[model samples]
Target chain A: MILAVCLNPALDVTYAVTALRPGTSVRVRSVQRRAGGKGVNVASVLHQQGVAAIVTGPAGGSAGTDLTAGLDSAGIGHRFTPIAGATRQTVAVVDADDATVLLEPGPVLTNAEWTAFTTSFADLAHEADVVTMSGSLPGGVPGDAYGRLIGLAHAAGTRVILDCDGSALIEALHDAPDVVKINEHEAASTTGIETDSAEGVFAAAEELHALGAKEIVITRGAHGVAARTGQGRFASTPAGTVDGNPTGAGDAFTAGLAAAMAAGLDWPARLRRASAWAAAAVAIPTAGAIDPGVATDHETRTIVQELPA
Target chain B: MILAVCLNPALDVTYAVTALRPGTSVRVRSVQRRAGGKGVNVASVLHQQGVAAIVTGPAGGSAGTDLTAGLDSAGIGHRFTPIAGATRQTVAVVDADDATVLLEPGPVLTNAEWTAFTTSFADLAHEADVVTMSGSLPGGVPGDAYGRLIGLAHAAGTRVILDCDGSALIEALHDAPDVVKINEHEAASTTGIETDSAEGVFAAAEELHALGAKEIVITRGAHGVAARTGQGRFASTPAGTVDGNPTGAGDAFTAGLAAAMAAGLDWPARLRRASAWAAAAVAIPTAGAIDPGVATDHETRTIVQELPA
Candidate 1:
């Protein structure tokens, strides 16, 4: 079973309007809301792919109740610890011209809350074959929260997938998680490199692998994903841009990678499968959903190149 | 007790940012969510003023749950009819420079839900001394819903305080409610008058009274209020601008007016107390709250010029 951890969950709200202007009230055309966070999104993708996955984290207040109830409605297994504070929300005001996202800084986790979550996570990790820790920790949570969780998962003989940035990602690297996945911006920020080319992205990956992660995956929006593992270094790109909303492409890739790893696929095959799911994500309007049989019907000639280490 | 009806209840989510820019992500500096709608705001102001009141309307889904829970947390009384669709959210992206409010047209109420709510409202109206029907009707609810409610309230011997705009206002006016309160813009829209001046507002109030409302009240932002009753035509203005968040000033005024009406105050005193409440509302950070002693000490040299009708 795959376990996805979202330390900071949110009620993702999307407001559609004909146009947005300053100093005036805009009549909203429509609104869509859903439970969200990188890990929760990954679990959503897993459930859609007919993979068994459980979503867990710190949830509380009415928003938390909504998030858990939403998960139940979606048929995704979840066990979120109830905390004192309300979960956060991410709002996107979309018009024909653009989509403006407002991300709220989540609730601050008290020491006791973090400790309780840690105990619960360790027990769940023991029963999981693959554990994916995604998203940033909320305020008051130690930056090394994922690193600490990695240690617990390792002790339970579970393979860990770390997907985050900043101090959290840096801290988790010290434990050498099985896979570290990130987007171009996070990769560039980590290495201070303009990863606009394959060489630059490969340079960032080398740095990540050297830091401790056994395998590294770097996703480039329309350009697809590049990876480095003990077997070799490879990059794959879909034939062309599969445009829609690319918000959860990376999370879908992570879910695909986890599925591939659990299925004991070879390193190159893992990249191909991950790319298929990422492409599927881009072809959809929402983040956590894919076109019917996107991965199965993925006939796109994704060019895979074996880059030198 | 005052029964405030908010047909389209909302979770008012305010996101404060250093600045707002479209097509990019903004990190929210703070988030504040409250149960909101015209009647809800009126009820909140009454609660703050130590007035007995109960709020009710159609509520459902997660946003509804959040709204009701927030109302409970705020110590306000509410009974909402549950429905299948979620209640809507109105988001305000506030910055130091400007506040952009996005108002969502709430859920499409099924015929069954509307009937259930109408039944519930009639029962409550019978017990209410005054029924304040405010806000816009949600989708799937007929434009004359408030008019129908006014009819029900009248049958139940409840004095109706109508506050709305467009077709709803026109329809409710036909029911000849006890009082009709509205902001200058709404008054202007209803009567085709540019009510930016005291004379213009008074003219609009006269038109409303002629249209069958026993009494008329028109709020002019920081400029204060003007009224027309059987006894006389009167106007009151704050000495100067009482600047802050003016979002709830109208609601506060409605509450003050309802309280004065319930206390059987004279027309001039009712206008004065209502103006004081509105001014006090502007001095505070939020809409439904007033600065303590402002109403008592509102020595704001308000000149009440008795207008000739």
Candidate 2:
């Protein structure tokens, strides 16, 4: 079973409005609330793909209770460590024209709560085959907390996937992970390499691989993704770009990669599946997971090109 | 004892922001939530004035829970009738300059719930000396529900003070309430007498009184208030107007008038106390209640001018 950790979770509230006028009242046509955090999204997607995955995180207050109910309704297994503070809420105001205004930065977690969460994290990792650490650390959580979890997963004989950025990602690289899926910007910031070309991206990925990552996947929206493994390097672009919502494409890719790896697929196949899932996700508005039939169709026809190492 | 019924209560949330920009995320600097509804405000102000007042209303959901807790913290007695639907919330965006944009039309109550509320209304009125029916009726409630409440109170020997406008006020007048407090606009709308002058306002109040009201009190913000009683007509203006929030001035005036009448104060004295409370309320940022000390000071020097009937 796969386990995912979302250190900072949020109650995502989406408000659909015909038009938003400043300093004026607008009627909300509809509202939807869901549990949202990168790891939660990834685990939810994995569950949708018929994979056994459990999501663990910190949750509190009425908003947190609603988030737990939401995860249960979606059939995503979850265990939340109770915190003293209320769970943070992210408000997304979506207009008729599909424009979105996201108000984020949810509740802050204290050190005692962070410590309690880590205990749950250790237990979940001990029982899982693959452990994925996703999203930002809440306040009071150490920046290197993800790295500590990576170390714990390694000792437990669980494969680790690091899906975070900046300092946290940099620190996690010190303890080599099986895979690191980062966007182009995060990759540049971590390696301090200017990636203006495919070669530059590959060079940055090599630098990260040297630091400890066994494999690196850099996703470039619309331009496709580049992956570097011990076998070699590969690049894949979607057949055609689709105009759609791009909110949860990366999480979809992470879910696809983890599922492929769990199925014992080789590095090349995993990259191909990840790219296909991401492209299909971009075609749909919802995050992380798409229909299995759509994902299969997109994967079967996706063109993953071999790039010279 | 006085009873105030806010059939349609709300958790009024005011978000203070630097400025409101359309289609952009805004960081709310401060958030203030209060128990809100016309009758609830009046009850709170009366409680602050050391009067024995109880607030009864329909409250549900988390927002309702917060409102109940707030009223309890303020030492105000209340009984909430739980309903199927959640209590509505009104969001006011107050900019740095204190300009407010109000969102209206709170939650809709069910028909069965409205019946239950009316039942509670009669029981409360039967035990009270005066009943003040305030605010707009939520959807599913008949516009004449206030009229029905006035009839119930009148039959119970409880002096009914109606502080609403439009159809509700007009409908309540058929019951001949002991007192009706309306602004210039509501008086003009109900009586079809333009209020361009004090005579016009008094003419509108006279028409409402003839329609069955025992007394009429018309409040003019900053300019003070005018009242017409069987004894005669009295007008009182503040010595000097202070610039502050005017959100709850009218409700404060109602509370002051109710308190004076309950104490058997003369018409001129009642008008003086009511105007002073209204002025002090407008000078404070929050609605309804004034500081006890401020109210005491204002009562000492408040001036009343008798007008020829």
Candidate 3:
């Protein structure tokens, strides 16, 4: 079983309006709400793919209660530690023309609360073969939060996939997580390299590798992903165009990668699996969901090429 | 004591951002949340003024739970009936230049739920000197909900102040509540008359009176209010320019009118009190709040003049 940790979970609210006008009142035609965070999304995709996964994180207040309830209704397992502050919320106002998002900074965590969560997470990490930590850290949390978690997972003889950005990603690289998954934009920001070209992408991955990442995958939307590891450098290119929603594609990719790694697949096979799942996710309307048939079709057609040493 | 009915209470969430750019993710700098609805605002103002009032309404789900908790924290009294559907939430995204609002349609009430609330409201109305019903009705409620509530208040020998618009206001007029308060825009939409001028305002009020309204108070932002009642046609112009947030000015007006009526103040005095309270509310940053010192200043200097019959 995989244990997924989301440091900052949100009650994601999406409002569909016919038209959104600034400085005026708009009636929402419909509303959709769900438990959302990168780790939660990864768990959802894994569950849908018939993999056993449990989510753990800090949840509090009404939004936290509602998030837990939503997870329960979706039949996803979660063991969240409670805190005093309310969980954050993300509101997406979608119109026919475009979508606008308003994001609230998540609740602050006390030192005692973070320590307690880490203790519980260590216990869960011990029981799982692989652990996944995703998303941004809430306010007041230690900057080395993911680094500590990675160390705990390694001590438990379990592998970990770390997916985060900015300072958190920078700080966690010293811990040498099994795999690090980041989109091209995050890769660019973290390494200060323009990852718009293959050479630039590989250079950023090499920088993260030198910083102690065992394996690094940088995903370029629609273009595919390039990775670097001790074995060699590999690139996976998707076969056909698949389009719907790109919101949770990264989570879907992480889920596939984690599942393949747990099944002891090689790096090439893992890339194919992850790319297929991501493409399938992009073919659906909502995040953290994929069409199994589409994934199967893309898996066989996905091309993996080896780069020169 | 007065009883205020808020059939559709909301968890009002306001987000402050440096700028709101559509189709992009905006980081909210700060967030403010409160229990809000028209009648709830009335009760809040009354409580601040030291006037005894109790709030009643239907509340459900997480938003409902938070709404009541907020009210409790504010030291307000309430007895809300429970329902199955979750309460609604309204989001206001404010930038330096302007504010955009997204309004959710409130929860749908079952016929049984409406009956249960009406029964509870009747008991509360019977014990109070006056009752005030404010704002729009939730979906699945009877169109004549305000009309029925007004009739019940009359049967219990309790005066009622109603603030609603469109079909609800038009249908409720036949019940002849002691007072009907509406903004100028609502007045125009309800009577199909352009109420931009004093003459048009009075003409719209006369039409409403013909439909069985005993007293009509039409508020024209910053300009003051015009009224028509059995005592005579009277208008109250605010003393000076007062401005801040006008979101809850109407509710403040309703609270002042209810307070004056409960104290047996004459029509002219009631108009002056309502106008002063509204002006005070506009001088503050949030809704359901007022500057008492500003109110006293406006009240003494307000101009009351009789209009031709």
- Which predicted model would earn the best DockQ? 3
Give the per-residue lDDT digits (tens) of candidate 1, residues B1-309.
999999988998898898888889999999888898888988988888898999999998878998998999999999899999888887889999989998887789999999999999999998897888887889898777988898999999888888888788887787798889989999999999889888898888888878778899888776767878788887776756766877677877788878888878877777877787777877888766887577655634556667776
Pairwise TM-score winner, candidates 1 and 2: 2
Task: State which candidate has the highest TM-score.
Answer: 3
Docking class of 1: medium
Residue range B218-238, candidate 2, lDDT tens digits:
987666677898888877777
Model 2: CAPRI class: acceptable
**Which candidate number has the best lDDT?**
3
C-alpha root-mean-square deviation, each candidate: 3.2, 3.0, 2.6
Off by over 4 Å in 3: A192-206, A220-224, A227-233, A305-309, B192-203, B220-224, B230-233, B303-309
Tell me the tens digit of each residue's lDDT in model 3 across A170-256. 999889998999999999998899999999999999999898899998898778889897679998889788968888999999999
User: What ranking emerges by DockQ with the best candidate at the front?
Assistant: 3, 1, 2
lDDT of 3 at B290: 88
